[model samples]
Target chain A: MDHGEKRLMDKNQESLFVRLIPFFERYGILLLILIMIAVLHLLQPDVFLSWRNVTNIFKQVSWQSMLALGVFMVIVTAGIDLSVGSIIMLSLMGLAIASKAGMPWYVVMLVAPAIGFLCGMFNGIGITLLRMPHPFIMTLGTLYIFRGIGNLISGGVPITGFAEQIRVIGNGKIKLDVFFGEGAREYIPTSLILMIVIFFIFWVFLNHTRIGKWIYAIGGNPGAARAAGINVDRILIVVYTLCGFLAGIGGLILAGRTNSAYPNAGLQSELDAIAAVIIGGASFFGGRGTVLGVFAGVMIMGILRNGLNLMNVSVFWQQVLIGSIIILAVYIDVLRRQLATRT
Target chain B: MSDNLVLEAKSVSKFFGTITALQNVDLHLNKGEVLGVVGDNGAGKSTLMKVLSGLYKPSEGSLFFDKEKVTLNSPRDSQNLGLEMVYQDLALAGNLPIGDNIFLGREPTRKVGPFNFLDHKKRKQLTEEHLAKLKINVKSADQKVEELSGGQRQAVAIARATAFNAKIVLMDEPTAALAVKEVGKVLDLILNLKKLGVSVIVISHRMDDIFTVCDRVMALFQGTNFAESELKNTSRDEVIGWIMGKKD
Candidate 1:
């Protein structure tokens, strides 16, 4: 080939690699999760890879995983909803009180999410309408307010003995027969199914819809999105509302699983959710995240916590490890974005 | 008067709190005519185009498009009316595929029952066709806009406008980031838009671009219309004087 043709061939080969780069980039977090899982299996072969242990982890973490999904949306908009934990508490306690009053299980489920939605709407209005700076302040204020309300209503006590039907969604599992060597049985928790469904919906919303694109665009650059004539205030309201709705769903599941609703039902859940989102590759600067990333992030967190519990690790050590992971994930995000921009 | 008058603004003025950004600016553009809007920084050039393209509503002014007085409430509204604005930034999502970015908000959708899915195949085919029509060559539609050179991005922006059936395109400093050779490609694209019966309003500080592609040049100084003349008739010195707010 002539020099020009040879150079063109080189360029073509380079671009072919460039095309594959996005697939790797998109699945980076998932890859990290798999590697982590593999390493944990190697270290604790029997317990880490056990079917019972895996199902237990999924059941235990699905509620908080839902909250993490909610926080992911808030963070992507370059905002934080510190009140998500409080909202979850409200959802659980409020649903418990309603159920105790002889409300139908269906009505209880519907009412739980409604309370969460209203609470979220409150935050949305407070920030967008009042023109608050940083969702941190707005959500923080709401966080305290929500927690206070939860305590006042429940009198700092737990309510127990929820209806069996309501509890089934949280504590139930479906057993499947796997043809592995023989007809061995495999079990998947219903919460895992819920988690998967929630993940799928958010994934489609974030990647496919016009509203989803607008959310990212707004978070990426509000000024630019405004110049593009996006209804910024409306989108912000919708995002907060959605976050609240998800928190409420999480609250219901938690209450159902424990067969009780308490003021402290979701205590410290906000921190865990935020940790998961940050660890899943969301940027604090805004407008860069994926639903799948958040899913894997939550799984990584759940797996770590499960592994630590099995190993009899101290609570203090777990906290320290999680904190370090959050920092590392955020650092990785910064590095990835920098590399993306430079060339 | 040209039969091809695509966009007409009548006494459009915009204010920001206490400051007047644009004051009763009357501008006209015809199909296949390349109009250069030359202005210094902060001369309300951006403000005027923003109003015309529906990014900003004039505090006081009316606009006419294709002989109809209409209010452009949003960018989508402007796009529906067959008007497109290519900002200096190009308002492009660099991480997205070139075809996806080209058809960002208004992606062609195929319906199966009530559900509408993005017609990716059709979009890729149309993107390639549009790029080819503009005589701009690229490796593939799947390339992220970020991977492309500045000139290629510009080509993508123009192709997007053309694909959306935009008859009047307001470009803000389209060549500002391009290299010298790339600028030539963009200038050629402007002429190509004229050949396709598209009205183009270009905002540029580059005098040569104003001289090369633009048929008529309009100068703005301190939020006022200073002068309007045929590109060939006006001297570069005179245009510079108008831009600098010189009375002579």
Candidate 2:
């Protein structure tokens, strides 16, 4: 090529690079997830690329992802629900006790969520009506309170042997007989399906409802929302209540899978859920996240853990790496905000 | 009360602990008239506006809207009674789109299978139409408020207040952050609102803005209403004197 022509082509390429910068910034996390999957596949092609292993990852992450969805909503309002982990334990314990007390399986399902709703209402009232200094303190207080109650009710013992119907909700799978080769079947975990359905419903709610719009508005600037005539306290209460309800569902799934309800089943699970939400691109200060991003975030975490296990990585190192990734995600979010404001 | 009076505050007083923010401050707005509220820092201008906008309840006295006694306990109540306020901070959700912010509290929705969903198409169309009528130049209603300039943000806030067809609109330092050229546009907006038979109460430090739009000027001094006069009856220097505590 001529020197002049080469120079013109270089200039065009540079301009194209500049134009694509914003798009890359917006979808950087999704790209990172894809890259992680590729690297894992290269390291352990047989295991990482297996359909069974992929479905297993989804099943394992389903309950935690449900918790993340709840945390996502709470965080969208610029609030945190530390009590969610404890609420899970409490709901599970409630289910176990109800089952042992001759309550029907269907009634136990309804009661579990109701327990969570009441617990969430307690936190909401403390934060909204009592005008607590911060939601962190209020939820932190309830976390211990709920945990203590769980211990008291269960006597620090794990309850096992739930009804078959309850167990099926957690561990049941849909067998697709026609998908694979002859005499081979593919299994989709019912829990995974439940998580996906919940996520889809919430996605529509957040993007297509007035309440969803109000959630964003309240998170963006609560004072402005109040001035705009929104019932800020009521919405805040509802957000926390919903978080509790979802956490309850997660608790029941965990109980079903384990065939037991331990007072400490969900200890520190809030950290994992919060990490997923943050990694998914939800800002700590609120009002900036997407449902799809959250799903990707949960899947990335699941993939990382599954792949690391296949590679025989120590759990200690995995913890360190995951923690570092969380910090890095938040740091990237800060930089993205700075760049946006600068432009 | 005269039939011309759209709103009247009868000796409203507000106290925060030992601090007296406002003391028996009586004020009134006539229908379709623009009233300018001027005061120095800590002179109870915001406090009075807060009371009028229902962000605060007066410790004493009463408020009458359209010559009927009414109590405003919250911002929602004031809005329901056809009063809207544009705060100095603009009070806009920065991360929300222009259309969402404009219709933040009262969003249009469509019912689907017993569930209410936001009507995005209707909201966008109406927002575009309203902005066009207001002569607000913007790329689209979906543009986030954070992406807009200070002047544009101010225009959006004003449009939100006026779009609801409010009987009375209160503005607190609306042009304090705008460029000189943008200030002229805001002044024109206030004039347009007045022509539509909407009563306006503007609190501004800029004498130019007050002179350009207000029919009457009210001076607040040390938490009290010191003086009020028609624009033709008062000079800028005289009003400045009252604001500076040089006259009572």
TM-scores of the models, in the given order? 0.88, 0.90
Could you tell me the lDDT of residue A314 within candidate 2?
100
- Runs of candidate 1 with Cα error greater than 4 angstroms are A1-20, A177-186, A337-343, B9-26, B40-51, B54-64, B67-80, B137-139, B146-155, B177-181, B221-225, B245-248
Whole-model lDDT, model 2? 0.90
What is model 1's DockQ versus the real complex? Answer: 0.26
Docking class of 1: acceptable
lDDT of 1 at A3: 100
The lDDT, on a scale of 0 to 1, for candidate 1 is 0.85
- A94-205 in candidate 1: lDDT tens per residue? 8888888899888887877899999999999999999898789999999999888888888889888888778878888676665343455577788889989988988877
Query: Where's the lowest-lDDT run of ten residues in candidate 2 chain A?
Result: A177-186
